[model samples]
Target: MKKPKILVVIEYIGENGNSTAYYWSQIIKKLNINYHVVLISPENKESLKFSKLYNVDSRLVKVGEHNKNSLISRLLGQIKQTKAFIYEIKKEVNNCQLVFTGTNPIVTMVFLSFFKKIKKFKWLVLVHDIFPNNLVPAGFIKKGSLLYKILNYFSFLLYSSPDRLISIGRDMTLLLEEKIKKGNVVFIPNWASTDKNKPENKNKNEIILNLGWEDYIVFQFFGNMGRLQGLPNLMKAIKSVNNEKARFLFIGSGSEASYIKTIIKEINIECNYEKAFFYGYLDLNKNNMGLNACDVSFVSLAEKMYGLGVPSKAYFSMAVGKPLLYIGDENSELDILLSEYDIGWKCKPGYSDKLALLIDNITDEYICSSMNKNPRKLLIDNFSEDIILGRIEDVVISTI
Candidate 1:
């Protein structure tokens, strides 16, 4: 059977796009057995890199450059830039039978792409990470006025009207229930690629001997250190963690980087970290080298985002089988997963002592058990992409 042509709609990608976009691109490839995928995103020059990195057939949509420096310019640029994207998608989707929108406000962009609903086209929306508050960021940008309420209501209306709504994590599905809790919301764990960059077991003696033997326990946090990552709590716990043998590692760049460093300086906590260091984000395939070098993996998110978006890092981190330390709400997806698997530690968002205690508790045996997480095993047993994608394919093919 000839594969159906699938059009994937996402925002910026390739040049350091958000992690969610990377996953969607992977999904496109995972489904290649069933679909011929065409990826569309805002990135132009980066789209080439994005294509190579994710190994997807990517086309740079003709959108205006996004201006991040000025507040007003940012909003205005997004609207105008994304509108141009709509023009391209509309023109392209004539032969495309199925359309998939990834976890982004870009669903709204897809909606705006249409003057009104086109007659027989199928639209499948995967809601990755959305918050009720963000349904209308225009509200905060504007004061407590009628405009805020109007935009919020409109945004909700747009979201609630989707044909099919899929949630990546269970908590996200529950949140969707609060609003439109009817026949639409579906739950699936985020899919991981078993084929690409499969992890290799490193012999500790060879690796350690090669590196000249580090005696400290390494606590590593990968991914962006954005505001919601509860980095402040991580840093504070690093401060309070009295063990000289415990090293706290912060990887990736984010808004909180400066503040975190400032606090580390204000309160001399270098002792808290046996060998404190900042290793900026790098390609994941290359960074797997660093993973073999680490003793533990840490994850955190802002308290406000607890139930909203399930952090993808938690699943992969656990797959790495290093003890996972995630800071978030008790009910958040990562917290629940970390606890259920007995894979690592969980602390409430913004609690430093919990993190400190977690750091002090890691033993060499614990590290060995954690690394046994066997990501491939977990995927085969729990979230196999073949099964998950088959389920989604049934939805798309049936819709068409």
Candidate 2:
């Protein structure tokens, strides 16, 4: 029997590396199904490599050039991209059995939700981030602004129309339940590929030896350095610690990279110990080596960001068997995992003093060693690639 084909639309696959690409690759490889990817133009080499590796067909839509400096240019680019995406999807979707997507390219979700052609197929929306709601708290727009009101209404309409909505956390599902039918949503947390293990001997790792991190308890914050990460508060917490034993590392870049750099510079001027380091971004292959170099992982979210999106890096930290030190909403999904699994610690957002205290408390060698074992076990039990994707397969089979 022939396998069913599903059309998956995401904004961009691979200039650098993305969790979305990693995610779909696993599903395509393991599931007995075919996938067609619709992406925006200026496709990168990494995306091509990913397509070849996964045996999935990719179709690119030419949305004009993106100009980051100009708001008008950005709006025009999205307009073109949305139109192209809608046209291409309309042409190809009729042959597919289901349509699967997320809310990344907000324009695509806005147009695709209402497109008549899509209503014929089973539609599944993976809610990675809740918009307008997130934007308002982030200060991107006023809560009562016309743009906010318009997008909020569209979000309600779009979310309500989907046959199945897959949310990344329990809080997100609860938030959606207010706007969407309870039965239409399913909670499937984001997962990481568990192909790598924690290094047996950190002393033998070349990267750690080169960085001279072997002597310190490395606390790494990897992935995007965006505003929602609450990184400024983390830097403040690190400065207040006055500890020689802990070294904080920031990886990756985004809107807040420059601000993080500025804070680091300010802290260095006033302090004798080089308490923090910024290494920018690493390639996909080096991710394991980087994670292994650290003793513990740091994850943060602004208090307002709760229920808007889950910081996916926490899953990667667990996959690599490193305990996480999370700074965000207490009793959140991450907080619950840390508490129940005995794997890590959590503090309220912006509480650098409390964060420092937590770090100090975990410095005992026995405590660290004991905590390390639980992360990978947690991954195997709940967040492993096989387990999560298997759930996705069940959903697909049932939907079809």
Candidate 3:
């Protein structure tokens, strides 16, 4: 049987890139078994490694060096990067039978949607983050404004262009239903980065031992401390917590890092709970230690954050058999998971009182004895890389 060629256009895919790069690498690895896969991206060592390991044909795009000091300079640089990628994709897209991509550099994808109308190749889009609409929650743009309507019309076009639209969150699939036909969307949740089927022993973690947090019930929030995470609400919840033995640990750094630290300082003084600490970004491989060190993993989304995106860290937290303490929209994906599996607790983003009450009641003894025996089973059964990629492969092959 002749294998159909698939050209994957993405912005990043290497050690330099974030977790999404590793995710696509896994997806490509699975696709390589039955398809002729070609990749187009700016050069990275991991991409080169994939070229050798999976027999994927690599096409490199030039990424412009951008000045980060000003918003205008950064926007210009992104335009240059997008132009370079479009040129590279155009050069190779004709040779491939299918084009596979996610919504990074979404502007390029929007432009590519127009090209899809003229070309015969099948297009598949894996929706990670919904745009313009997502921006509305962050106060980036007004929902019904001229700019929002214009970008949303193009987003509709982009959604309609794909032969198959892969949605990571069920809420996202529902949201896309408004833009395109329901038959075109497929729901597949993102998987854990770790392959482990069981929890790592906290006693074995050097970081936990050195920090003297062995006696406390640790709640860890590790990832981008970004605007959309509802971090201010988390600070409010932390301030309301009265449990002296309930420690909070932050493992990643971003825009709200300093703000979170300032709030932690206030909490330490006002509440006299000196257990909270902000440990700046650690290397990728070291994330396992941080995950293992915590009794519960904290994941939060800002108000009006439904269907915009699903955080990948929640799955990583599940992989380590840790219960999740989620704060986000009601009936969001995390809420659904919590309801189905008894995996953890959920509070609405703005309700710091509810989150605080939930936090104060969770004890080490209760977590160890009363909680689900194996939270990692969720990943093992449903969200593992192999399971997710299998679903994706079926979609691709069945469509072909």
Candidate 4:
């Protein structure tokens, strides 16, 4: 039987600390079993390795370097990247029976709006992050401004063009359903890599022992420190609570990393093991180790960020059996997960006093010894790699 050709267009396929790349690589490998899969992504060592490993056709593009001095520069860089991606997709559009992609370079979706009509191929889009809606929460644009209205309308057009829309979170699915008012949204939750992440002994783990955090209950933040994370609010809470019994660890770098460091210095947290430690960024192995060492993992979202995006790192933390201390809307996906499973605590973003109170009240005995093992068990049952990949394959099959 001749298999239908499907083109996978994703911006990042590198496996170095990129969860999207790793998962999509798994998706490509799975889809290759049933479909003639072709991939278009920026050229990288991991992407090349994946293409050879899976024996799938690949069209690799050279991504340009971007200036990071200011937001405007970054926006310009993103625009350039989107144009390149669109050009590559245009080259391969007519050759494939279906096009599968995620909203990485979001502007590419606008071009897909045109391509789908021109080529008349079934387009399946996974919404990793909503664009103009998320931008408002990131403080990049106003909610009701003229520019926002224009972008939102274009976003609606882009979304309406897709044959099926895949949402990673329940909140996101609801938002999309309301926006396009269509029955095409599919809820496919993200999964964690069980092969790479497993629960380790907090007491004997090298990351914990070497950092001298054995005496304190560690609350760790192990992902991007960006605007949407509400990191400043968490920092404020940490500053207000100044408890010697709890240790704070930040394990990734982003735009707010410098600002977090400045706040840490202002709080005069000792460099020793008493207060807080900031490690800029670590590789996958080290990050997994850090996840294993923490008692509670922090997953936060800014105000009005309920359906914008869900942090994928939270799944890795859960895979290692760490409870979440989520700071965001009570209606967020994390909040619903925590509330349903009794796996963690929640707080609103911007409520520094309440967050500080909650931090002070969480005892070492409760968090360390009494917390349940549902985190890892939940993944084994629901969010495992095989399970998510199966769901994704089903969506692709239905689309085709």
Candidate-wise lDDT, in order: 0.63, 0.74, 0.81, 0.82
Against the true structure, candidate 4 has what lDDT? 0.82
Give residue 143's error in model 3 in angstroms. Answer: 1.6
Clashes of each: 3, 0, 0, 0
The candidate that achieves the highest TM-score relative to the unseen native structure: 4
**What's the TM for model 4?**
0.94
Q: List clashing residue pairs in candidate 4.
A: none
Structural similarity to truth (TM-score) of each candidate: 0.82, 0.90, 0.93, 0.94
- Residue by residue across 201-232, what tens digits does model 1's lDDT show? 44452333354336656677777776667777
RMSD of 2: 2.8
Question: Candidate 4's residue-wise lDDT over 235-256, tens digit each?
Answer: 8898877566888888888889
For residue 332, give model 2's deviation from the true position in Å: 2.6
Pitting candidate 1 against candidate 2, the one with the higher lDDT is: 2
Could you tell me the lDDT of residue 64 within candidate 3? 69
Rank order (by lDDT, best first): 4, 3, 2, 1
Please identify which of the two predictions, 2 or 3, would achieve the higher TM-score against the true structure.
3
